[model samples]
Target: MPTHGVIRRFNDTRRTKEKMTPGDLCLLAHFYGVSVEVMALRLEDLNLLPNGNWGKLKAGGFRVREAQQQLGLGPLPAR
Candidate 1:
């Protein structure tokens, strides 16, 4: 699915107006086929703070390159 579509789905599933919780981040990470820690790191790189709790975060606020870098996966393959 497209990135926006995935994010929309995640937001819909979350059903919250606040930032995403840690569990929400976990589920979002699963949706993107990555680990929660990696997702957290990516969020951090994106300038989104992830407090060491069930803290919330703005969804769909990061890019694939940020996530890849957090996972040490390098740049994305050219289309």
Candidate 2:
């Protein structure tokens, strides 16, 4: 699927009014709390839960943050 199609599907499946455009998703994955690789893995491979497990996404974000730390990326650089 095209990137936009994937983004639309993600937003629809998650029922996230927060807009999961590529830009937002990239920002969320790369800078918010999750690492890009983890987010890509989860979002691309995991199924959405029927009982509202959006926290898992946040956890993915946290993992990204951790990866960034491990790779010497630092926390958002204080900007």
Candidate 3:
């Protein structure tokens, strides 16, 4: 795990905006215990976000907020 200073430097906004370098990629890969190739997959390269309800999304399902307010649906059913 990175110390506070290292993490802070990575997120500092005062610094000029720059693209992630190869070293940054390696750091993230090691942190997540994943390969550099996997870490390199940008969000633009993905059709849908991971760990989300892709089944519902693909079938044109609405999110909780949309279903509740716009469609006037009840709260989510019990698990």
User: What is the per-residue lDDT of model 2 for residues 13-59, given as tens digits with 9 covering 90 to 100?
Assistant: 45856444434444545543554544455565544222223455566
Q: Encode model 3's per-residue lDDT on 8-65: one tens digit a residue.
A: 5445522545554444544544445554344444311342123332343435642434
Candidate No. with top lDDT? 1
RMSD of each: 10.1, 10.7, 17.3
TM-score of each: 0.43, 0.30, 0.34
lDDT of 2 at 66: 48
Tens digit per residue, CA lDDT, model 1, 1-79: 3456555655686576566655566566666676566666665554454453322333545444454455555432344
Ranked candidates, highest TM-score first: 1, 3, 2
Q: Is candidate 1 or candidate 3 better by lDDT?
A: 1
Q: Give the candidate number with the greatest TM-score.
A: 1
| Candidate 1 lDDT trough over 10 residues, lowest sum | 49-58
Candidate 3 regions exceeding 4 Å error are: 1-17, 42-79
Model 2: runs farther than 4 Å from truth? 1-21, 30-32, 47-79
Clashing pairs in 2: 33-61, 34-61, 34-64, 35-64
Clashes of each: 2, 4, 0
Q: Model 3: which residue pairs collide?
A: none
Each model's lDDT comes to 0.54, 0.49, 0.40
